[model samples]
Target: MKWGENVKKEIGQKIKELRLAKELTLKDLSEKADLSIGFLSQVERGMASLTVASLEKIAQVLEVDLAFFFTLPQKHEANIMRSYGQEVFSVEESKYFYRLASDLEGKSLEPVLIHLLPNQGREEISPYSHQGEEFVYVLEGILTVFMGDEEYKLNPGDSMHIFSSLPHEWANFTKKLVKVLCVRTPGIFQGDKG
Candidate 1:
């Protein structure tokens, strides 16, 4: 299977496992998530992909962090260095690829290298919001960020910081590829304390 498909399958399995552990049936979860039963069932079976907004809704309904679906089961190191050709994953149908840049478990920050292809943008997907803060530094090409009612065009060497609670989305309008370094606070991938 492709990377996107494999990742989706794994995430779907995790969601199903968590739901069962919480003693919630598919119908129950669908009701809480404000999604249809058929859609939820398809997601659980890995036959469908979900956007970050949809995943956030399901995460809220399941009482789990949104990052729970992204973390791997392997141990993370305190001092980490990933060489070239490191693993990268897609954010469902977003057409963006990201590779985790930090390995400090439970750390306050999560850094990722995000690659946005030309003409591929988040406008097709719903914007998502979460608790914390985010800093994005454009490494190459240009990035168009949509936050609430405003839009910001960022070029290489430009950066923006914002509270993540606001609805946000991004896209690359340039013909060239866009690479950004994004750092977020509150460790979204950290294990649940609850």
Candidate 2:
């Protein structure tokens, strides 16, 4: 195969990975990309090529830059996956304040860096039952995490770990913004990347 063929293969693989990460089905993504399902399948399998315009359209529908569909994963160091710089997961602007720094990507652990705005409180949603465990460490400000009938106030450098099957919720109980580092072992991001 030629060098261009190799590049095309890589791009196709990346597209497949991104699509799966976004939990988009062939039908879902084909409609969003404004392309036929057959065409998308061919492109993903590298049996066909796409124009820059088509690629751009697909990337836009996927809510990612075209360049993002080309980034290669780095070699794992001690089974830990790391992403640096402005990496946003599921880029929804509402529902919560502050920014998230990371997400679980094809790894056994989901590590999220969260930022909580002042006076912002996210009610205890429901206990999520998944085949994994959760660990949380406060980076700054004050946070109160409710687990079942128990609520714990967390300060900077405080950490907690529990089975993810327990019901839990969080709220910022301070004037300053709260930052937390949460790692969910065994990856709970099966398809909720959206």
Candidate 3:
């Protein structure tokens, strides 16, 4: 992330150092984390920025808490995420922009507000699997979810819950922008005091 390149480099170093300490090869980590080896390599070299979800997967395979990588805030406050001034993040050129919505200490769920750009689709990308369960509620426009061979078209106020391990991807085919509230079980993000 251009917003935090130095921090990203430090994190990459930490990941590489720990992976070496545990005597795990890149291939080993890749297979265990279900992440592409090339992407992991790029991350370790600080040449790539990954989403919080991907970072969580790496942390799980490395058997370390997120605190090992991030310097979190010391004080804890109300978990409320205000409407304004939220940092929006995207992976590379991804059309989906996300704002971390929940930052409570010791929380069990991580909720993110996703903004899907207009007329964007996930046709070129293959659905991939990850760990945990996810609940997505469409807040505006239409959100399409492709799960394996099944497809679902969700309108405003509609929601879907499914196992994250199922190969799936979210998309928007309309010309209007789409917004969704996504919450994941067995929470993976530790915003403050990580």
lDDT winner:
1
Off by over 4 Å in 2: 1-84, 89-106, 122-127, 192-194
Task: Please rank every candidate by lDDT, starting with the best.
Answer: 1, 3, 2
Sliding window of 10 residues with minimal summed lDDT for model 3: 185-194
RMSD of each: 3.1, 12.6, 4.5
Q: Any idea what lDDT model 3 has? A: 0.73
- Stretch of 10 with least lDDT, candidate 1: 72-81
Q: What is the TM-score of each candidate against the true structure?
A: 0.79, 0.47, 0.67
**Candidate 2 lDDT over residue span 2-56, tens digit each:** 2255556766788888889999998998998788999988878877666444666
Q: Please list the C-alpha lDDT of all candidates, in the order they appear.
A: 0.76, 0.62, 0.73
* Tens digit of per-residue lDDT, candidate 3, span 1-194: 24267766888899999999999999999999888999899889887776555776788788876556765433323665555646565442335445465455566577778787776646434576666788999999988889999988999999999988898887878899889998876544442232
lDDT for 143 (candidate 2): 84
- Angstrom error at residue 109, model 2: 0.8
Instruction: State in Å the error of residue 87, model 3.
Output: 4.0
Ten contiguous residues with the weakest lDDT in model 2: 90-99
Q: What is the RMSD of candidate 1?
A: 3.1
Residue pairs clashing, model 2:
127-167
Model 1 TM: 0.79
